[model samples]
Target chain A: MVIVVATMPIWLPATNFLTLTDGVLAGIYTLLGLSLVLLIGYTGQLALTVNVTYGLGAYTTAILTVDDKLNPWLTILIGVAINVAFALVLALPLLRLQGHFLAVATLGVALIGFTVFQAAPITGGPNGIDGVTPLSIGSLQISSDTAFAYLAWIVALLALIGCRNLISGRLGRAMQAIKGSEAAASSVGIRPFRVKMMVFVLAAVLSSVAGSLYATYTGFVSPDAFSVSFTITILVMVVVGGLRSVWGVPFGVFAILALNAALQTYGPSLIPAGGTDIPIVGYGVVLIVFLMFLPGGLASAAQRLWRSATGSGGPRRSMPEIGGAVSEESS
Target chain B: MTFLFAGLTVGAINALTGLGLLIVYNVTGVINFAQGDFVMLGAMAAILFAGANGHRAGLPLIVAVVLAVMCVSALGGILERTVLHPRRKSGPVLLLIMTVGISLVLEGVVLVITSSQSYGLRNFTPGPALSVFGGTVSLQSLWVFGVTGAALVALYLFFSRTRVGKAFRACEINPLAASLVGIRPSRYWTYAFALAAGLSALAGAVIAPVTTATYDMGLALTLSGFVAWVLGGLVSPVGVVVGGVGLGVAQGMVNGYLPLGLVAYANAFPFVILIAVLVVRPNGIIRSLAERRV
Candidate 1:
């Protein structure tokens, strides 16, 4: 499945379906979804700051490459480092918060990040910076649509492999233990704070890397691209794909983006009133429906369907319960 | 002095929005992310009903205001009954995301209907500005403050003296116990949503004259109101009011003293303060009685 998706640019356009640009977007969103899975799914931290981190990475790469004349590849590293630093600083105060409080705090930080992006003159004040150079090695530039698609997919694949390795190691067990019960994890010699901080930084770095690639690919960075809606879309993708599965990231990103594209392409023809707004409306409806009926998301649904079809299920795989009751007392 | 009055007016609006959030949260244990949209709905509905800004079929201002509030309240009731009530057993994260979806849909609908245009409502009573403490205050600002005060007083009375209000309080205290005493939590949930919607709409209507109304205004208002709610610890009404007003004043001061460049980022002040407060006192400035015992 990974090989098929990674090599999609080779054959996707011949079918006259999704373009190379869509592939690039799918790659970016998949990176974001995977990063979110690391934090929200694995560590049980409800964070909404992914978009801001993505913005930071984009802006960093855009400004560095455009103004400071730095190498695009080097800028990506710098952006990731800066994002990890920011995440650590943010996590210091934020790690203490739990549940809705943590979610709200991260949201506040994202909102603040957005306001700064809009207000800061260095960010070009909402118009955003342009003339972002594409990624290159020596004199060979990866600027074309097809080339950027390959670059994005290659990086996405590496990130996926790295994340899968991390999840299969001791860190993954620590994350699952912490997510299950922070108290129990700590009592059993796991440092919840350290594990949570590591996962948070890792997620931020991954998101920043995706953001840097996005800027490099598009050659422009705008405030509108990093809005709360973008964050919400990535979140929907993570939840819709299946939170606990690494393979769910690509599935979620591809499904939602395809749905959006299909709605945009065919919706207006089907309904006279349908226009650009149809995709947004479609997204809203799909998110709500999935949340209501398929809480474990499409990945789990697919697994269940496959098992039932083969009639080989001795016992059903239960969904990972994410609803840990944490302090319901109103204060 | 001018900043103080400006802060007071905005603070009153924030307080009302926070109160709306507090009410729903106390009853349902879920934060209504769409609270600010209710404010937007109130303002937009009033504008449309009053035939303001090229709108047809003008109604009397009082009648328009009442109709707008009622419409928004009914929307809140309908939303609670349909989308949320069926999924009440879902986790907090799912419920929160559901509210976000609801907010997106509400904003989308308003955007389509209003054509993404901003609208303004006429002040309650247009008149000359009054000079006080070396600062001129608009009559509209005074009206905003007056309405906020009256609403707060009325809300207090409703919560303390009325039977339905006591039922709301009972649900907040203990939903199971409240149900045993013949108070249905679901009924109060719907009521709390409507009440909060009405209050937020009222706030939006009053503030519309000053800030104007736009479909996209909900998120900012929600964030600011949420900041106030967090600062107040999400429980006490009086604390919410104080936090709201204090936040408004701090924002006013930032705008007054900061550089032009910094002033452009003044909207983030409450959020920054919210983070700081949460870090220092996760329970907020006013701790609940149960928390104090620990």
Candidate 2:
């Protein structure tokens, strides 16, 4: 799959499928999805503010690059820093709330973030920032859709590897333990609040990176680009993609993106009005319907298929995980 | 004075929306994100039946209002049965996400129906605005307050006096025990959702004139309602009423005080108070009389 994605620019000219832009987005979305899974699936945060973090990242990149003339690469670090600060401020109040309370508070913060993005002068208000500095490594400017796709995937892959390690490491276990039972986790000497805060910050940073990359690729950042609905869409994508395998996220991202693309391509023609909003209903329904059939998400279904395919599995993975996240999470 | 009246008016509507969330949560432990969508539907439905919003139904105002409420309530019941109840066994997180789906579907359908046009509903009783405390309150504001008060009174009576309402409380206490007592919790679940929907719809019908009905209004109202519910401590009716009113008043103050340059952010004012409350009093300002679910 990596090879196919890596070599896609070579063979893609021969085919009629125009997914090069979606490829870039899917890569970025994979990072966003992974970050979400780390927060909700693994860390038990159930956050609805991923969009804000992503938007903050994009805005940070946009502001720094456009106003300060800072290198786009530098803005990635700046974006991460901003997201951490934002997350820290939000998590301080949020840590006190749990379940629906946490979710609602985060949703509120996200709304506030959206308002700020739309109204604040720094963010260019509702118009957003245009003429964003494109990402480049030295003189080798990362221009063209194909190079951008590679840049996104490489970052996504690196983030995926980092998250995979985090999931298996001591801190990751601590996060999982907290998710299961904070009381039990703390009894074993884990500070639940501290761990939860760390995970939240980490997720924010990841979202920020994805958002920054997205801004650079698009060469624009606006309040219109970041919305609560997009946050929900990301949540749906991660959930419907499946929660069991961190590796399955990209596949889920692509599938959901494809579903969206198909809807966009055909929705307006079939429907009389509201073509732009049709994809959301389709995805929302897909999330609900997918949960009905595959509660663990498509990754779980994939694991099942792999199990039936492999036949001999004792502590062995049903499928290959992206960046070597295989076996441990499997049954 | 205007701020106070505005707060009271929107406060009443927020209270209704919060009640919708509260009732459904009490019965089913699910936060219906679609509650605001129901309110939007009710307002739109009322407009449609009243021959407003380019609709030619031309029904009488009273009949149109009744039909709107009834239709929305029925739709709520149908939604609970088909979309929510089937997924009752799933985790709360999944169910919450499902309500989001329901909301999106509703909003999408409405957007398609209205082509994204905003529609105004004629005031229930056309009258001169009342001057009180050096400010004039629209008649619709009176209707909002009146309907809310009557709804609360009716709810109090229903819960205290009606068999089904008691059974709903019973179901809230213990679904297993309620089922054992031949009080079908499933059936009551439908009723609770329908009741919540009816309450929200009624709020929409009254405030339709003040705010107008739009396809996208439901999502923001849902958050405001949730904030009101959370401020009231998620479990208690009294808490939500107070919380809703408090939030509304707070919002009124923010809108009153904030500079015109910053007024665009006033939509986030209630949430600010909500988060502050969550930080200071995590259990909510109005703690339950008895121990409740955290």
Candidate 3:
């Protein structure tokens, strides 16, 4: 609400590309954050592969749109297809590992993704792929910042609705059951493996959408943007925003962005060294503080404030378990 | 012949890393992902301490290494007892994220204090080449192998002969049962943390001379150790040692035999190995062997 009120004029101003870019980036985060919440928050899987999935999406779109000269609509579909296939291949065995082992394994995936994108010449290596043309609909073009922002938010909103529908349906209940106890869920006829794999593919596809939008917005894709640290940052957002709630995703992303902007704009002069690198330090501090104290995430905190102001509790969602609660015998 | 010795030298370092990882994993049921960062801290501390005292030549290198390990071990004990143990019931995902957060803070703090430039540890070995069998090797490489071997033997003895070590293993296998037997679970965690940190310190002290120390070196080391642990099997010291040696030899051979373009892909070895093992042997080599025992 404050964002709309504060940036009302910038949306239409000719020199407002920077503000438009920020809004589009926030929109992309919404998609990434929502996808992460679906797997991590809803299904209780601690996946560290969001950024890798995002990179895959971007790379897929880049190759199809630029190298192959595919249609914009076709490129998006191809991107989703690639991510889904990757997820299926990864999910079959990757889902068996639990706890820190799973986290480390996923971290390895992210690192490998970075290495492949950085080392492989076909993917443009370190310099990254450039000249990615924006999506066009006849006369309408998505090259400008304002158009990109609106398009990104539209896709993000649709994804949010799709997630809401899934969570509010039978599949949602199955996922929740799986989250609470895989053995019990299986006993009750819910195939825990199928549910996990479904969620993995779903999350990967959503992340791919965001990645494609991000590629269109930037007109470039680099390995640097999809490093392991990017994965950590996205996890921090989900954690800070409250993992279970649907609305918490955007709240987390904007909070992180606001923090980033604040540090970038104001932190340099405050430091004796007088440099722009303190934002990295700030992001690190924010993550530590949030994890140490606000374990339920920023979403829960936001709900608390809303309830206090309105003199009633807002709709509350049960805090999802962070990982699998049921231990399975590897028989 | 030197390639063989290089394999052993790198293998010894990997073994030390795995030893640290096994200690923490056994006690806490949580892998300390920040283990490599601790190793980085150890090496950085030694370099700084050396810088402050290296001019005098009065402080012996052995004493400096001991002090560095002591300080880092203390830090480890404090972190485990206070920050980590307080939220033990939160499960492993949060613990993993928290450790990652801690790693970020440590890396940043290291950068803030010392800058991001890599440093070299002063080598004390005799410069002359030593001959063995039909081959010649650097004296320093032989020392790395010897020290790592002694450390492993000591660890073996400690676990087999000491009351605390037995209690620690008991705690690992069944925490509630061990607590009933009057072993405080928290104390075991402290011992694990201290021991893990000490192992990291020794790894840093030994390898920094060869690899050069940097703030970010810990992540790479951690990845190598992680690959070795997963390959050999987590929580098995002998498996870790053997895995470390095997991995080092594999890496050495790749470096020696692979073409120029593939050599640039050498750093990808650990990750490729990790993905393959996770996909093919999620239970790890030792666990699979043990599973077949039944």
Candidate 4:
């Protein structure tokens, strides 16, 4: 892996571009991943509806800019509104379902979203809503790579702050309480259902906002972009980053993307004629290895190293793992 | 009338898929996401065999179906012992992810081995059409309906009449208690997996003539089965069949009666029903009736 990173520029022209472009992509995905961490990791809810919310954001921005002739700034707000409303409708009932059933239910939402985008003529069917006008100020278009990178960073930073505040505040405590035990939480007047629904909805709205900006930034929207694969990728990011550690998300995103990039660049040399397909094997192996060894994720690994370096002698508290269970059944 | 016959034919296939899903769900208590992949592999294997062994005029369709089922069941057993057994102690979510990972590996391997082109499993042509209930029906449709009905009846008898079947039921109801009573739950898991894979393979072999084999078809079918499972309340065989057929007919009806805008919603019907039922009744439509049994 180190050798691949060292020799990257020799093979991938995107190597220099990757340091910049990949960084931006990491930031964007981190935003989404952190939202998922808050939802699934801290709140003890399993939601596979991220892609649907994302598509809704993209569609909203596309429609507003292309059909309604609304400004890009206004489109962003509309995107958030649409996403929140959709999440509200879904969360009202979906929050009640737990475990595999909840996962299936959210998966249904995503599948239905995919079907709507692919089959409905108004949404351009499989062709998708394309030709979205790029977000711009009156005199200067926010079309350059540097500009868009900054835009993504700003949004990601705000989202990070929002998530951090939510996690540390009274609401965050209530959410953690709910995660620990819903019955106990409600007994203490936390209103676990409503709080969970609120967090889920907020997560959806944030993801949608990111999606809208992404569509406008990329100037394209396709059903292919918002697949179950994308949802899984986001979930993997949170799991690989150490859920509940807000600072770990970017590392998680970067780790996976870097691994993917490395496989794409140097995998062919390692296995003759394997080509780009080796990453398929790489991701699976990485997931299994991480799940077995580093269940707390890369952040946890870094924390261990830092603690050792500082010679802090206190016994470390075992991080409360919310959903992971080695037993056949998990609540 | 022809479309109704077509719908019925597809409905029978859905029944087979539902049956395959139920067997695994009953014994192992894991909703195998790779079920559709097994179906796809079965069809592909049969297609390859037919190409290599010659699609002879005298070869029986039953023989081809049996071969497909046997091969796929063996594959299921291999997968269960190798990947699933190690992760037997994991939570359902982790197991779910493992199955998905297994699915990803299977898809990549299949794509590399098989060409991207679709293949025809042409041996199962029940030649000629006949009149049935004021509609033109093919022998193929009749064969599918008959086979699925027979399979279900056989399954019902086996579950009720055989000691192994009784053991399987005991495992499903309560694995801990079943183990106390000397039933090997792990062995049951392998057996149930084999049963599900075999049935899925048979369904694939039957439907391959109508729909060609594609690498990614399994994922969608698996998702639909999940929707059916949710709609049917997960544990009831009768409810599963009803839900599966109802979903098929619902999609068919939307295709038949709706306008273009609404017809596009046909594919989304299962998901829409799923979300609705989840919101309205999380336990599914039969939850109230089956509360005591469950």
Candidate 5:
């Protein structure tokens, strides 16, 4: 799968389907989606900071490169560190909240981040900073769309493998245990707060990486680009693709992005002009449909099919529970 | 002083939104994110029926308000029955996400209907701004206060004096035990949602004259209302009312006193309060919800 995605630019014609820019966006959004999966899917902390950290990364890159003329590569490291610090500080108060309270508190965090992006002078005060310097090696300039596409995908795939490995070991078990029940996990000697905080910060770092790449690739950073709507869009992507499946996260992102692009191309004709909300409605309906019908998402469906094909029909595994009211179980 | 009055008016509306949130949350344990959109829908529908700016001949103000409130209440019940009923067994997190989905759909449908146009409503009662306590208060602000105060009293009475309301409290305590006593929590879910929708619709209708009806306003309203709800500690109805008023007054002061160049940051005030309160006291300013229940 990695090989197919990485080498697609060589063979696939840009004339018809996804262009280089869209693929680059996919790579960036893939990181954000994976962060969501790790935090919400694996850890069960409904802290919505994907777009916040992503914005931090974009702003960090945009500010450093445009204002201070710092090296773009160096800014990415600084952006990740900043996002990590932010996540650590926020997770302290947020991890104490349970279920719905935690979710809304995260929303509050998202809104505050948005305000700072729009109001702060350093962010150019809603006009946003433009004229970002492009990234380059000692000799190789990453100015072309195709080169950035490779750079983004290579980094994305590496992160993907890193996340896959990180969540598959003892730490992964601890996370799943916390997701199931904090009391039980604590009884077993896993500090729920530490585990949750670790995953949250890690997710923020991943999102920061995406944000940095996005700013340099787009060559501009704006508050409009980091609206709360995008955060929900990413949530829908993570949920629709597969919540717990690491490899399945991109499938959700690409599928929804393709759907959205298709809508933009064809929606005006079918729905009439000024029907921009059609795509939004599409996202919301897609989220509800996938959650109700296939909560495990495409990955679990594929896993079930694969097992049936192999003639060893495994007993159905229960859906991984998140932090919320266990109304049915408690009752 | 004028800023204080303005804050109180906005606070009343925020309280109404928070009240709507508390109703559904207390009865069903689901935070209906669509509550603000309900307020938005009511305002938009009323604007459409009563005619924007009172230039176009349309339904009378009373009739228009009733129609909008009734329609939104019905829609809320229908949504609860159709979209949320099947997911009743699902965990609360999924239910919360589902409300978010519902919010998106409502906002989108509203955007389609309104064509992203802002509608201004003529005040429900025709009058000049009244001078009270050295501050000029608009007549519409009085209407907003009247409506919110009436709602608070009615709800207090309903919860304390009516069997149905106590049944709601009963379910809040333990739905299973309530069910054992032949009280169906599922039935209350739809009713609570409908009631919440109606309450917010009334709030939006009354407040629309001051804040024009717009498609994108729902998100702000949701943010403000949620902040108020959290400030009340998510436990007490009366606490939520006080929470909403305090938040409103604080926001008003922030807006009034900020330098001309920095007033734009006041929009972020509620969010800052929300994060601060969530970090400092997730419960609320009032420590014990049990002692202060409506």
Candidate 6:
């Protein structure tokens, strides 16, 4: 499946379906969605700052390459480091908050990032920093849309593998334990805070990587791309695709981006003038419907159908226990 | 002195919004992320009913404001009944995300309806600025402070003096116990949602003249209100009011003294203060109810 997706740019256009650019976007969304899966699905932490971290990476690469004359590739590492450091700083205070409190706090962090992006002269303000230098190794440049699509998918695949490996290990168990019950996990020597912090940083790092790739591919970095709405869009993808499944990340990402792309192409004609907002309404409806009817998302729904077909009986593991109610649980 | 007045006005708005959040949170155990959107709805609806930009057949300002409040309250009630009430058993995270979805939908609907144009309400009272302590303050600002104070007093009386208020408090204290006592938690939850929406609309209508109304304003207001709630420790109503005022003043100071380039970052001051408070006093300046458990 990964190979087929990676090679989609070569054949997708033959059927006039999706393009290399669409593939690039899907790859970016996959990275972003997987990051959310790490925190929301595995650690049971609700964060709205993924886009802020993504912006950090994009801006880091954009500023370093444009203003400091640094290599694009080197800027990626620096961006990731900065994002991890920022995440650590943020998580130290934020991890103490539970449930909706944490979500709102993260939203505050994202808003602050946005304000800085728009205000700081170094960030180029709302005009944004364009003419971003693309990634190059020696004389070989990954500037073309096709090449960038391949590059993004390759990185995305690597991230998926890394996430899967992380989730299957002792660290993953610690995350699950913390998600299940922090006090119980602590009693068993799981160090919930440390584990949660690690997962938070890992998610931030992934987001930063995706952000850097996005800037490199588009040759532009704008604050608009990292707004709170963008964070919500990524969230919609993660929840719609399925929260716990690594394989579902691509599907979710593709589903949302394809819908958005389709909407952009056909929405205006269908909705008439000044009704471009119909797609946004569609996104909200999709999110609400999915949460209400399919809490575990499409992946879980698929699993349930498969189980029924195979003559499996007993209770299904459709809904994972909600993790953000730690405070209520303690009470 | 100017900063003080500015801060007071902003703080009053924040406090009102925060109180709305606390009211719903206390009863439902769910944070309505749509709280700020209620403010937006109130302001926008008022603008539409009152009409703007040479549009005639506009209702009187008071009537428009009342109708807007009622409309937004109905929205809150409908949202509670249709979307949230059924999922009362879900976790806080899911509920919070659902509110976010609702907010998105509201924003989109408002954007479509208003065509994304901003609207301003006529000030409740038309008067000249009064000079005090080397600062000139508008009569509208005075009205804002007065209205906020009155609302707080009314809310206090409602909670402490009324049976329904006591029932609401009971629901917050322990839903199970409240249910056992024949107090239906769902009824209070619905009331809380409506009350919260009405309160937020009041704030929105009051502040609309100063801040103007836009479809996108809710998210920012919500964040600011949340910061104020955190700063107050999410406990005492008075504490949140103070927190909101302090935050507003601090932002005003930052705007006044900070360099032009840094002025944009003033919006982030509430967040920074929130983080600092969380680190130093995780429970806030006033101890939270959860902390009082001991």
Highest TM-score against the true fold, candidate: 5
What TM-score goes with each of the models?
0.94, 0.94, 0.90, 0.88, 0.96, 0.94
**Fnat of every candidate, listed in order:** 0.43, 0.48, 0.34, 0.44, 0.56, 0.51
Candidate 5 residue-wise lDDT at A146:
82
- Residue range with the least summed lDDT across 10 consecutive positions in model 5 chain B: B285-294
TM-score of chain A, model 5? 0.94
The DockQ-derived docking category for candidate 2 is: acceptable
lDDT of each: 0.83, 0.83, 0.77, 0.74, 0.85, 0.83
Please compute DockQ, using alpha carbons, for every candidate against the native two-chain complex: 0.45, 0.47, 0.41, 0.44, 0.57, 0.49
Query: How many clashes in each candidate?
Result: 0, 0, 4, 0, 0, 0
DockQ of 3: 0.41
Residue A8 miss distance in model 5 (angstroms): 2.4
Expressed as tens digits, the lDDT of each residue in B143-241 for candidate 5 is: 999989988999988988999989988888898999999999999999999999999999889989999998878878887988888888777887788
lDDT of 4 by residue, A45-109 (tens): 77888888888888888877887888878888888998888888878778888766787778888
Error of 4 at B16 (Å): 3.1
Off by over 4 Å in 6: A14-18, A318-331, B286-294
lDDT of 4 at B215: 75
Tell the DockQ for candidate 5: 0.57
**Taking chain A of candidate 2, what TM-score results?**
0.91
What is the lDDT for A88 in model 1? 95
Model 2 residue runs over 4 Å out of place are: A10-18, A312-331, B53-57, B288-294
Candidate 6, A32-122: lDDT as tens digits: 8998988988787898898899999999999999998899999999999999999998888899887667887788788888888888888
Residue-level lDDT tens digits of model 2 in B1-294: 889899988888888899899889888878898999999999999998897744464788889989999999999999899888876776676677788888888887888778888999888888999999899899889888988999999998898898888888999889999999899988888999999999899988888989999998998888888878878887888778878887888788888999989898887777787778778877677766524431
Colliding pairs, model 3: A240-A298, A241-A298, A241-A299, A242-A299
Better of 2 and 3 by TM-score: 2
Q: Of the candidates shown, which would achieve the greatest lDDT relative to the real structure?
A: 5
* Residue B81, candidate 5: alpha-carbon lDDT: 95
Q: What are the per-residue Cα lDDT tens digits for candidate 2 across A155-201?
A: 88888788889888999899878777788899999999999999999
